[model samples]
Target: MTDSAAEARPPSIDSSRPHPARRYNYWLGGKDHFAADRESGDQIAAVMPSIRTAALANRAFLGRAARHIALQGVRQFLDIGTGIPAPGNTHEIVQAVDPRARIVYVDNDPLVLTHARALMSGTPGTITYLDADLRDPAAILDHKDLHALLDLTEPVGLLLVAVLHFVRDDEDPDGVVATLLDRLPAGSWVAASHATWEHTPAEVVAELQKSNRDGRFVPRDGDRFRALFDSRVQIAEPGVVSVADWHNDDPGRAPAADVMCNALVGRKR
Candidate 1:
């Protein structure tokens, strides 16, 4: 709950075009999205109905990864491309495990920044939000707020969950990851999930590619997503599996392959 004065000056939102964060919120059954977002979500869902499931699974994976990272004694978190604040956010999960945990969430979307303050108001100084994009990891790393909240000398959880697909090939998403990790000490960890078109039918892939022509999404295969970690970071067990399968306590049930999203939590060596 931002103060009335802060709330009065909300960030500008372009509801005419569907934003990825809002569309993701809509898919996750959140109320922060506009009509355009819902329309875009519906269009994508109609082609690949499993996206809704992927969204939920991705959210759960974030919680699990955050908790696991906190349990590993890492108190600081940097979550980039954090979409519209929803239940089970990184701060909530990490703070639950370690009450003194610190978190910095970065997102370029103005609507996300507005809703972020409201959702994060309860946990004041422990959490901070930065209006930044993933394309320039260096800028985010050098930002005053991020520097103030996170100690690069110590271990920090670098969370890139379900946001990398938004970075197209020309952007060198792998280099972005490396650059960020290079700035952190050896103990820091990277937990990430990315959308993929590996197991889907050719027609399904075509439809998704056509819909994502705006370059908002660039779904990759498991190999490419995993390669982002490179030799600098080592992935943990159950390496690069679907979000539903990664550290899932549910045991017996496995989600359908076509709807799966690649997920992994790697530690810097």
Candidate 2:
């Protein structure tokens, strides 16, 4: 890692407590998680058996959205709440479309920061990582590394896949997204997905919501999820739908009820 990246590293990682990124990595069948993460993931999986499928579908949505945006001629991307290094990452997908494509990845997790080098291993100077939180859009937008790699004046792809639910309602998640979108120039696109309980059993939803009293995961319905984009963008064709169904033609795609995540791509007006 570079000096700046090392400086951004947290003092130490707390493996004793479960983190969203690590737990999600565990669910995605990655080996970068600890016992705490595994146990937490297992507990959730027991309740939501298709969570692993959901994770994979969400990952697929990210790649498809990145390619969709890149194909639209948007070469610059800002991906916040980036989880651990995974295949088909934003840089990899978009850079494949155009070698000159530039990307900035942001994540507050210390573990993700530790793997920043892997995430940024692409065309020289085409990708960078920031140790920042989505709740604090200014910190991410104002970061020198992000500005160095991405030009806000150009049409950029802003990715928020499967990350917004972690931000509680009290934190003003909509304002956070609106703030980020407000800074990007017109024609910029935002591809986002959020966990939902719309299709989940009422008893299960109640259990999940009660268990999440600490405000860790806040699942929204279709209408509430759609409201996050505000009036600054135009929802693309198909609007918000299951992550597995977005631009996916696989006959084996999991049902929306099983995936329980909604995804959408919108262009800033």
Candidate 3:
């Protein structure tokens, strides 16, 4: 294969175990997933039929939220838990509005890092990828790469899309969000989407829980999810609604009722 072709190919990911990033890629109709990821996705979809719809909805919300923040004149971004390279990624969506946009993407998964490095080849804006976990907000905030691209005094867009659910309560997910936001300037924004069980059925919830036996996903209620933003940050308009209903540019593609994810954008006070 040509160099470009090889770059276009998905990384050699492990197929023995299901990974959240790969499974999420599969749901978003990307080619970067393995059989194990597909099987896990299929099992989740079998119980919660709207899993794919939810993924699409969450992706759409990311685009809208990024564009909104970009228009608000935030030229720097720190996107945590960035999954595999897919259509409408954070840099693509934001840089389309402002070519000068600088973005820092953080993800602990190696396969995601490989694909992300490949995607950075022809990217127009200043984009850097970091192999880091969200559980360690201090490392992310103090990283040399992050500081090189983003100025702490300037307004930045802190994106935590569909990743915080992986952070268990024991790790203090809410505190983590607060800590990251605290490191940013007052005008900076925090945009996030988290999975919830509010709209799911009891049996389906149980099955979903069983599917995530390793405790990677921790679905929260609407209030608990909102609490992640805390009182320091002021919630933006259309506060913490379903991902399908969060500032959707394409309302026709609204996800199904069972999508079960809440989204919100907040500005630091």
lDDT of each: 0.86, 0.88, 0.86
Writing each residue's lDDT as its tens digit, candidate 1 over 160-237 gives: 998998898999998898889999999899899998878888898888777776787888899999888868888999
Q: Give me candidate 1's TM-score against the actual structure.
A: 0.93
Please write out the lDDT profile of model 2 over residues 38-96, one tens digit for every residue.
Answer: 88788788788899999999999999999999999999999998889878888889988
RMSD of each: 3.3, 3.9, 3.2
Residue pairs with backbone atoms closer than 3 Å in model 1 (clashes): none
- Return whichever of 1 and 2 wins on lDDT: 2
Question: How do all models score by TM-score?
Answer: 0.93, 0.94, 0.92
State residue 64's C-alpha deviation in candidate 3, in Å: 0.2
RMSD score of candidate 3 (Å): 3.2
For candidate 2, the 10 contiguous residues with the lowest summed lDDT are 1-10
Q: How are the candidates ranked when ordered by TM-score, highest leading?
A: 2, 1, 3
Ranking 2 against 3 by lDDT, winner = 2
lDDT of 3 by residue, 143-173 (tens): 9988888899999999999999999999998
For this target, which candidate reaches the highest lDDT against the unseen true structure?
2
